[model samples]
Each structure stands twice: as structure tokens, then as C-alpha cells.
Target: MNRVYNFAAGPATLPLPVLQTMQAELLDFKGTGTSVMEMSHRGAVYTEVITRARESFKRLLNVPDNYKILFMQGGAIGQNAIIPLNLMGGARKTIDSVISGAWAVKTQAEAARYADAAPIIANSCDAAGRFVSFPEFTTWNRSADAAYINICTNETIHGVEWYPSDAEAAVVNASGAFLVADMSSHILSRPLNVANYGVIYGGAQKNIGPAGVTFVIVRDDLLDMQHPLCPAAFNWRNVADNDSMFNTPPTLSIYIAGLVFEWLESMGGVAAMAALNDAKAKLLYDFIDNSKLYRNDVQSKYRSCMNVPFFLNDESLNAAFLEQSAAAGLAALKGHKMVGGMRASIYNAMPIEGVRALVGFMGEFERQNGQAF
Candidate 1:
């Protein structure tokens, strides 16, 4: 059976080519006669898989040699605690956080439990309690001696992204505090200046592969900043030193992530992906802007290309729209309850075909239901 277009947040869809490749190598990986799931992570075969995965990831991101790429088991949520535990060990207990939406709110709240977490400029919800734009950096109440500044580059649930200009990044970097970011939803969808960030992390499900693997790229110097209470396995230094194999790692997930990295490289790397992603997002957003019955409230400048949350003018038609969209092979269009209507998470795995299919369905749905309201 043909697969329906999956737009759920994550563990989101993956490339069909990657899935097919994994299927062909499922039971006997490269003549090793064992599934990636069954192989010893320490074995030479598995070692090659993970090493190549890391190398491909580095190549795609242009990660500096001063940085270490670690494949860990915790999702982004795990890093909520791990970040503070690792970074807040110095004299500065403050971790200044930029709150954009749901994940940003949660990231700051989680950090406060371990350190002196302070909100920098959180305008996550507007007067109408909707997240439409990111707060300007000038308004940030950034601490002078904060350990690091945590920013969720993309708000997964609220369809807002922070695409800072080079000048804006220069201002942020001037703060002297370490720059840490959660790029879970849009990690490899664009090119990133790895040098600007002291730490950048993301869960693999959305763009890379399945759940169970999380990638954290950190500056070499920050690895020594682990809190005394931080678990040895979770410590960046311990995990990085051990090559992300402090214990039984997420071998299967990492292997699949390896396949994803190779797939991305084959498609001319992140720059090509960024251009395609821009086109897809523009198509959907332009349609939404012109629609009579649908609207997206996110500010044009701060809109997320990875996730588009939209609403029907007639609120009651939500269920019908979702039902019809599913029947038309467009699945998981339901929005998060916090800001409900519909959210189509067009992550890196979601092809332009999927977005075109969704736009076609939306147009048909508007025609069918517009006159009644």
C-alpha cells in the first residue's frame, strides 16, 4: 500500500530512499550477517557505521575540529536537564533563556530546577495568547555573567522560528556567554554557522531518523564544565571522551541516522535542502495568506518553515477538515491543543510533493466548506 503523507511533529517521517536502503540492509548489514540492532556497538562493523555517521554529520554541518559530536540516547527533553547540569557548573549559576513557545518555556523551566534560570525576553504568547513573533534581543534581560544563553531556534509546537541576521548573531555573540540552541525541528534543513554556537543539539526523529538518538555538538572547552551531580553517562566530557559509547548506546538508531546523513549528503548537502525547504514553506504560507477561510497568525518574519500552524476561520470545522485531509492521504494535520486548529510539520523528511498534496487538499476543503459558514 502507498504510504500516507505523515506530518506529525516527530518521530516524523523519513526519506523513502533511506527507508528502502535500511530494508535492503536489515538482516545482514554489509555482509556482517546480523541486524544493526543485534550487533555489538564495539564491533568493527558497528564502529565504522557510527564513525561514518559522525563524519557525515560533521561534513554536512561544517563543524569545527574544536567541537565534538556526540550521539546520545536522550531526546531534546533529556538535554533540558543535561544542558544545565553540564554548563552551569561554573561560578555563574545563571542560564539566560530565550522563550519562543512551548519547547522554550519548558527548556527554561527545566533549567531553573538545576540552576538560576532567568528569562531573557519571552514573548512566547501575545496579548491574545498566541505566539506570532519572537521578542527583540534588545529587550532581553540577559545576565552579565550568565553561563550560557539557551534558545530554541525553532518552536516546534507554535510554528515560530528565530532566523537571526548576521548582525543579530554578532550582537548575541557579544554577550560573552556560551550560545546553546535546540535545533530539533530544523537541524539539517539549512546551513548553520557552527562557529557561533558553543553547543547545538537536536533529536534525530524529525529530519534525521527515528527516535532514541539525540545529537549534541559542543565546543571542546565546555566538555569539562560538568556539574558535580551530573551523571557520568550524561556528562558531555565523559560521553565525548568515550566517543558517545559510555554504555550501551542507541546503536540501531545511530545506524539509521548514519543512513540519513548519507542520504542528505547525496542530495548535495544542507544548502540544497535549505533552498528546497524555502520553496515549500513559501508555497504553503502564500496559499494560507491568500485563503479566505484559513489563516496563519505567525508573523511573516518569524514564521517556521519546518512547521506551519494554521486555522479555519470557522473554528467548528476543524474535525471535518482533519477527517477529509486524512481521507485524501494527508495525515496528522491536527494542531497542538495549546494553540489549536491545524499544524503541518513539513520537516526535512517531508518532500515538496507532500506539501503540494496538502495545499491541494486545503483548497478543495475550503471550497467545500467555505459557503456554509
Candidate 2:
């Protein structure tokens, strides 16, 4: 089989080993005479899968004892509403969101349905609504009783990342507001201080396993504040109390995520994955920075290690660049339509060699187009 390097943002490339392991167990998992997908979610075998997966995920992220990781079916978009619904009941009706990019903006719009959302245009570049820099935490106009502070830590579309430093954490902590993070693109890529945020949620398509599962890690105290109007299944407290089985969970996706957790543990966990991701990102970003024709517009400090978005100096060459990339086995090099440029999403499963291949292809394309490399 000809395997092209897939640069898709979600439903992205998974580790080959994880896929092979799943394939090996597909038809009859552990002598059960039934595929994992075919098994009862309540049965002992599936229960074991759930328990181990939760433990492995906690270990991978160093989740604190206070955090409850709930595996749900709705994607991150769902949490945009669920977050406000669950957390806004005890506080003022307003929710403050740090608008960074497309996802943050969308999340704020979704939250508006359930609460009064105040958008703080934190840091956005004039061109393409890119989030190249974040507003200084001290400058943010936070409300005293805001339900929570929402941040899209990694914006997949604009390729911006926010790794909150100690000072930033202190600022947020001082505001008397809960810090909620949408970490869809960069989850499991590194270790996160679970104590720093009130909630962290992500769709399990990039760094995790597949598209169906959405992981929500909420601090126990925050879960107890669900609104009376919140749906039973969407209530974090109920979901946590029921152990993520308030409704029929996404069983198959959870099983796949379990396998992925095992795979991450085998790879020496998140620290090792962070180092690998850093190397991959550096190779591509360094190449782009040096190239005369290509440029990555994101601020160096805030640039995402997971998704690298760049543009050809000559916009006319965009089609040629994509065509050549496809011919060279580097597929899906097109940037999101909202941000018209090329984006290479080098997630956990994207090896350094893939980055090297992409860099080499970019160099060749630049040379052919008579742009100095």
C-alpha cells in the first residue's frame, strides 16, 4: 500500500503501530470471539478497557486527583455550549472569552446561546484574523463574576498556540474565574498542569485516536455547579457521577482511544512525544523562515508546534505548490479556506522524516519556481 504523508488537521494520521495493533485485534479481541466494536460496552472486557484507558490517560497528562476525565460523544463544538451550560449556573450570566482565532470565535458564538458572552479580542493579527500574539494577561478586562475564561490553547485553523507561563497562570488565578481550555489540536502532545485550568476538553481526532470521542477533563468542584436547565447528559456533574456512562458513550471511539493511550505509554509518554513534536516543528518552521518564497506569519513565540501554516510569497503559485506537493507524496498541503495558505499539521503521529520530506519538497518547489531557497 502506498502511504502518503497525511497532513490533515483532524481525523489525522494515527501512529502506524496503534493502527496495526487495532487491526490485529479487530476480528476477535483477546479470544472473546467478537471484535471490540461488537462487544457490549457494559461487559467486563469493555470495562477493563475503559478503566485502563482512563488510568493511562491520567498518567500521560499527569492529571490531578481533583480532575475527572469524562469520555463523551459530542465534539469540542458541543463543549462550547456544554461548558457555559454547566458552569454558568452559579455565577453571573456572562462568560468572558479570549478571542484568538476561528475556533475561539466559533466557541464564543456557541457559548452565546447559553449565556451572555463577552468577547475580549485578545491578540489577533490584522491579516486573515490570525492569532499570532496573545494579549498580556494583565491587560485583559475580566469580569468579577464571569462564569469562566475560555481560551483555545491551540487554534487549528490559524496555527497559534498558547502555553500559559507561570505568570499568566497567576494572573488567571487572581481573577477569581475558572480557566477553560479548548485543547483539541495539541492534547497529548505534551504535559499540561491540570491544576492550572478548571476544565480542558478536546476532540480525539488529532493526538488521540479517532473523530467520535471527545474528552473532557473537569475539576470536581466545578462539576457541582451545573445549571438547573442543563441536560442530564451534558451536565458535567452528572457525567462525572455516572462515570461518563450517563448515556451510551461512544464505545468504539473509546476503545480506539484506549489503544492509543497504550501506544503513547509505549512511546515513553508525553515528554518524549513533546520532544519529537518540537523537532518536527522546528525542521519545517526553520525551512520556511529561511525560504524566500515561503513565510509563516505566526509570531515565533506563539506559533503552534502542531499546526504550521505558511503562505507562498507569490499567491499565484499556490496551485502549483499544492500540485507538486501531492505529486511528491505530501498530501493535504492546502491551508484552511478561512486562512488561505498552506498548513502542515505535524501532530504526534507525524514523524520527523515526514517533516524532512515536506521541507525537501518545499525547497525543490521553490527552486523550480525560481524563488531562492
Candidate 3:
């Protein structure tokens, strides 16, 4: 059987080893003669699955003991509301958002409902509404007493990412506000100093496993500040007390994510993964930079390692390029509707060979269509 290279943004491609493990355990997981999907979440078998998943996640990310890893049902969009609900109970009800792209803009809008949401709009977008760079750290006016400052670490649609450095950390710490990041698109692709952020959350679909669960890592101290209306299940403090089993939980997805965590460990963990991710991003970006036909608009310093959004110089060939790419075993090359052109979401599961193949296809398409205008 032939497997095409998949580049969907969410419910994205998963590591082959994880998929193989799932297949092996499907009929009778761990010799129990029951598929994980059919088994009870409360049973010892599934309990082990979740426990192992959490511990492996902790180890892989080097999470501090003070952090609680919660397997949740809501996606990032859910967290937009849940974040304010859980964190705005403090006397400081305001939530400051650092907007870089569409997701961050939406985050600010959602936070506005539950708290004093203020956005530090990035000067990163060009006059034509194109993202060309990231806002300078010094330019951000983060709220000093806000409950937390929300930022999307990587803007998938705009192909902009924040790779925090020592200088940036100092700026972030000086704000005297809790740092919360939505690392949905690039969570496991690199190593993050979990100490730098109050909350680190992402949907598991991109790098962990399939959809259905969003894994969250929240500092223990931040758990208690939930609004009065916050649901018991959505409250970090309550979810922590219940061990993420307050509800049925996403059993099959958790089980699969556990396999993925183990797989990441076997492949030398996040540090090694970061190195590979760097090489993959560089290979693709180098090609795009050299090709007059294709160009990535995001500033080089802030370009995403996971999602690379590029446009062909000749817009007329967009549909045909996608059609030809699909025929060549490349799927989901279409960019988000908000950003016209093509986006290649090369997540952890997307091997280097996939990017290489994609570059080859782009080259061939360019040659056939006409020279770069």
C-alpha cells in the first residue's frame, strides 16, 4: 500500500511508529482482548495508558514537578474562553493579548467577553495585511497587573513563530505578569524552557497524536484563580484534583498519544527533534528563497519551523499547482482560506523526505508552468 505525504494543519500526520503501535494494540491492547476504544477509561489498563502518557510527556518536555499536565477535550479555540475563565478570578480581571496573526486576533476577541482583554497589536503585518515580521519585544505594552498575558507562540496561518531567547525571557519576566502561550502548531517540534511560561497548552493532533484531546501544562500556583462561573471540569484546580478523569476523557486518543510520547523518547526526545526540525525548515526555506517563483513572506527571523506559508509568483497557477501536487502524492497543500496560496505544514510526523519531495514537486511545477515572473 502507498501512503501519500500528508500536510494537514490539524488532525495532522502522526509518526509511523505510533500508528504501527496502535495497529498492533487495536484488537487486544496489552493482551486484554479489548481494543482501547472499547475499554473502560477507569480500568487499570486505560489508567496505565494515561499515567504513562503524562509521565512520558513530563519527561520529554522536562516539565517541572510544580506543573500539572491535564488531558482536556477542548481545542485551542476552547482554551480562548477557558483561559479567561480559569485565570481571571484574580483581582486583576484584565487579560492582555499579544496579537501576531488571525489566531491571536481571535484570542483577543474571545478574551474580551470574560475580562478586560487588551491587545498589543504587532507592527508585524505589512500595509496589505501580510505578515512580514514579528513585533519587536521592546514595542509590546503588556499589562503589568493583568491576570496573564496571552500569546500564540507560533502563528500557523502567517508562518510566524517565537523562538524565545534569553533577551526575550528577560523582557517577558519584566512584565510582572504571568505568561500564557498557545503552542498548538509547534509544541513538540522544539525544546521549551517550561519555566518561562505560566501555561503551555496545545492540541495533540499536530505532533502528539490524533485530535479529541488538548494537553495542557499549567504551573501549580496558577490553578486556583478561576472565575465563579468556571465549570468544575474546566477549572484547572478541579481538573488537577480529579487527575483529568472528571469526565470520560478521550481514551483512545490518550492511548495513542502515550505511544507517541514513547516514540519521541525513543527518537532522542525533544532536543534531538528540534535539531531535525531546524534542518527540515532550513531545507524548505532555502529552496523557497532561491526560487523566484515561490517566496515565504514571513521575516526570516520569525519564520515557523512547523508551518511554512509561501506564495507562487504567478497566482493564476494556484489551482493547477494543487491539483498536480495531489497527483504527485502530496495532500493538503492548500493554505488556510484566510491566507490565499499554499502552506506546507511540516510537523514532527512529517519526515525530512516529505519536505524534500514537496520541494521537488514545486520545482517541477514551476518549470512546467513557466519561468518565475
Candidate 1 C-alpha error for residue 190, in Å: 0.5
Report the lDDT of model 1 for residue 290.
95
What is candidate 2's TM-score against the reference? 0.96
Candidate 1 residue-wise lDDT, 1-373, digit = tens: 5999999999899889999999999988889888888989999988999999999999999999999999997899999999889887787788888888888888888988988656555455787877788877777777887888888889988898985566766776787776788999999999999888889998989988999999999999888877899998899998988898998899989988999999999999999999999999999999999999999999899999999999899988988998889999998999999989999999888899999999999998999887867
lDDT assessment of candidate 3: 0.86
lDDT of 2: 0.86
TM of each candidate vs. truth: 0.97, 0.96, 0.97
With a 3 Å backbone cut-off (N, CA, C), the pairs that clash in candidate 2 are none
lDDT of 3 by residue, 1-373 (tens): 6899998888899899888888888898889998999988998888888999999999998999999999998888898888889988888877787778888888888999998656553446678987767677777776667777778889988889985566676676676677788999988788888888888887888888889999889999889888899998888887888889998899888988889999999999999999999999999999999987898988888999999999988898899999999999999999989888999999998999999999999988888877546
Q: Per-prediction RMSD in angstroms?
A: 1.2, 1.6, 1.4
- Candidate 1, residue 336: the lDDT equals 91
Best by TM-score: 1
The residue pairs found clashing in candidate 3 are: none
Tell me the lDDT of model 1 at 138: 74
